[model samples]
Target: MFKLFLLTSLLFLLPIFHCYSLPEPCSGTCVNAHDPSIVIRPNGTYFRFSTGGKIAIHTAPDLRGPWTYKGAALPNGSKINLKGNQDLWAPDVSLVDNLYHLFYSVSTFGSQASAIGLARSPSMDAGTWTDLGAAGISSDATKRYNAIDPNLIYVNGTYHMSFGSFWDGIFQVEMNSPPTTAKSNVQPTQIVHNSAESAMEGPALFRYGEYYYLFFSKGQCCGLDRSRPAAGKEYRIMVCRSGVSTGGFVDKSGRACTNGGGTVVLESHGWVYGPGGQGVFQDPVHGPVVYYHYVDTRVGYADGQKRFGWNKLDFTTGWPAV
Candidate 1:
């Protein structure tokens, strides 16, 4: 009777003590990814770009393991004439015309004074990045949008750069053929904006099949301990879809994305607290994959130590499921 009681008590306390110990996505010394953007080379080498340390770069064989941190993408820092250019954020890297084009945000936290800068590298190796000043997007007190967290999307035959945060939500503008800069249009069109919550950002657009999917992070991001938000107000991955690439996005509930409508792709549950800062990629083997950075509360709540996460998406139901 004593042995049975002890076993029953241990089983009851197991869930309470080990509930947050779910499978972690990464192995090795890779718990340092924040605002991570991953791109695979032709040879299947995974290059992960992230914020801070002049946009830290990491490479790994599989998403689940053995990530080795190479040095910063721009070790010498950015040439853009902006305050705190060395402490870059939100790097969006894409392979264009045999060159890796990297777009990063140059700004201070919370202030609207920001600019998105560009850099290029032939192979994404450290010490190969050449800063190209600004990519034609700048923000100030007078502007309605904050120029940060850039995500570039190529749709149809035109190239578009989607960016913005806090002040406006999300916006996109057309880029030239080379995508060196946004067109001379002074303003970008808004794609997704939550006038009520007013806390959407990190826009990533992916075109699959007949629809264009817009994935973004919504609610309060960061400060999980210092300034933690209410339960439902924490960061989570949300998504919407549009038939065309130029706007008219709607959620799975037939609600427009402009008015604070987004279907949740991944949210805080179990130990996955505030999973966001997401980007969608078409993997060579997994087809569609969504990668993001989420704070693992079982670890620490510091912003820079967030965990890098990825999950294969199932779109057979016309909506993406993890």
Candidate 2:
């Protein structure tokens, strides 16, 4: 019965081998992807939504893509009736109840007169979205938070959103429904901020094991040609973790996230420069993966093109390592 025992052992080990295999990184000409949010379809097709050019859409059959451009998600522009609302930035997508919900930022660069607009599609495809107008706005002169870089996550049966850029780091509000809108009664809580610099944005939240992790990009972004920061100081990814979903986030050294405290998650290495605008997704095969855009210094920053970057996350030591 040795052959029978050998066959049984092989079958048991097959699934374990498949689960631990690392995913192939995105390859080929990956360009013009900024502030990207990636989602996988039921059939395992990859759909990546990004900032600028009216929220551009790109698709690939696998992670290591022969990625194809699929045109703009919002061709006619936002229905918010703002002057510079056409150029959408930082679109976050999630599928709920058979509907694909897209939340994007509408504003002029460096202006606080901004709103986060909502759009939906039955299928997460380009040119199929219907804009649902303003989900939230930050038009008041006294308000410090800018309504941009929207990231939505479901925590403990409640829908919560963490959004804001530059002025006040990241803020969180409980959503009344999935994908769009927030509860009117609960005010937005300032969850993470950096006091050392006025540069903080692109807040992405992911829950791993018993703690919730907050990932955000800090330092100057864009205009690399005119004024690039010190070699290693340009846009970089930082992270903090909290036991509760809403507040009390701190870095590995026990420094509060609201007080300029963040542990560097990923930064520039060699040709990769200014890596930021990050989002985390759980791959069915490869566990947790971090997706973001980084400028290729080899191509020169003046070219104004950003490429997609992703790495599998390891939490074996109790904190995420790429």
Candidate 3:
């Protein structure tokens, strides 16, 4: 009877013990990236494209990479006639139709004058990208949405894009075949927003089980030295899920994402600070993984010095946990 009692008590205590355990810190070299979008090539190479001069490229044999710099994806700069076209941000890459399509943001910092550009390459190697002009555009004066931070996901033979930052949060638009531009005459739907600060962006949609999970970064990103938002609130990852692809997203509390609802997925802990601008990819070996950039506060806040971060996501609870 004592053995039976102890066994029952242990089972009751197991979940409590697990809940107190800290999450696994991201390992390996994480250097020089912001708004990183990663893809594993067919040849087993990992490529990470990030924000910088014409979209920076980093390659490695594995996810825990001794990453090597391979120049910019578009060394010639964007075809868009924006003021800061060379200084790109938030690149998302995916394999489509035997070509690797890379969508990147072209914009000046702190301005809504932005355009999302497309570049395609037969290989993931640098200097091979053929610039395919502007996929979408946004301006401060007329458009309600900003077109930076583009993320593309294909669902049931259709392509959909989620892009925007700051002004009114995340927006989704359908893309026609060839996947370069948005479908003509269709308006983008506002899928996620933060009522408090209007500070949600970096929409990464992942289809897991019966739900479509929309993950986005909320609060202030970048400028860690000069400014920081509320402690533990700045640049954290939040999520909502929907049964269908286009709309009806809600948080863990059953609140609609359209009304500033989201469940916190990852926030600052230990050395990792302001971990935002995230993307999700399914690894052949590690299952589902979330990738992003975080400020290393120990190293002091330096421009372009943010480090890469990734962790295998746990979905046993029917929702993604880092």
Candidate 4:
């Protein structure tokens, strides 16, 4: 009887040990360092960029951090900040032609005024940042639309960016300059449009096998109580796959993403509400991990304060199954 009681107690305590063994006081080291942009350098270092108007460097000999923060990857206050600027939002980083290019969003939050700018860093080390200047700007709120969430991808010797916020859904632009050059004629084209079910934003693009996967977040972000059952709204990470980079993106149901084809890749369960601003990276060892943020619906937390989290990515059937 005594041995059986001990075993039973151990079983109950096992769950507590497992849960508590994870990290605590979720911060930059956790995940979703705001709007995370992750990249791996040739030397096997992983760097992350966030939307706090600053880029953070996470260096590890391995894919996983026990990852350390070096500092901002770009010079402070490099934005033009012309009309109703809201610091920096989502940043996309990539290396091309032996140089590093950082594309980021400058927008006015609730307002439509927004722009996408470019910066360069010779190396991933701290303080090697340089201001390359604005790559493109929207003409006005309506026609020009909100220019945000910039992601760069090189395909067949052509540099392409997936970006947009309000008005049209996610937009794509081609870079005329070499992947390294910050100055380019980014001609905007509508690739994805909004739907009635949700408003889509924060697009991250990646290609695996023969399919081009566009990973995006939809619905309200921030607000800790936003995902409460009675809240009547949800923020989720959704995905669509296409044969072409420009995309005829469709969901598992074969519905176009322009018509709300986004199938939930990650979502709020319990108190974990994700207005998924995310980045996908090919880890040298772990394969690929989706780094993103979510609202920790855990009790006794302040409003608008969300926690960051990361999970090993699973790609089955050409979709990013997180």
Top candidate by lDDT: 1
| Clashing residue pairs in candidate 2 (N, C-alpha, C atoms within 3 angstroms) | none
Per-residue lDDT over 1-322 for candidate 4, one digit per residue giving the tens place of the 0 to 100 score: 9999999989987743211111123333644367777777777666777776365566655544566667776647555565533356677888866777877766665666666777777785778767665776554555644677888888887877777765668877777757543235456777666656436788887788888888888776654443343343566778888998877888878888877677677776655655478877776676777767666656333332554567767687666665
- Predictions in order: lDDT: 0.86, 0.83, 0.84, 0.67
Tell me the TM-score of model 2: 0.89
Which residue pairs of candidate 3 clash?
A: none
Clashing pairs in 1: none
RMSD of 3: 4.3
For candidate 2, the C-alpha RMSD (Å) to the true structure equals: 9.9
Give one digit per residue, the lDDT tens place, for model 2 in 105-209. Answer: 888778888888899999878879999998864544467788888888886688888899878778988887664687878889898887778789999988899
lDDT of 3: 0.84
Query: How many steric clashes between backbone atoms does each model show?
Result: 0, 0, 0, 2
lDDT of 2 at 1: 100
lDDT of 2 at 225: 75
| Cα-based TM-score, every candidate | 0.91, 0.89, 0.91, 0.82
lDDT of 4 at 215: 87
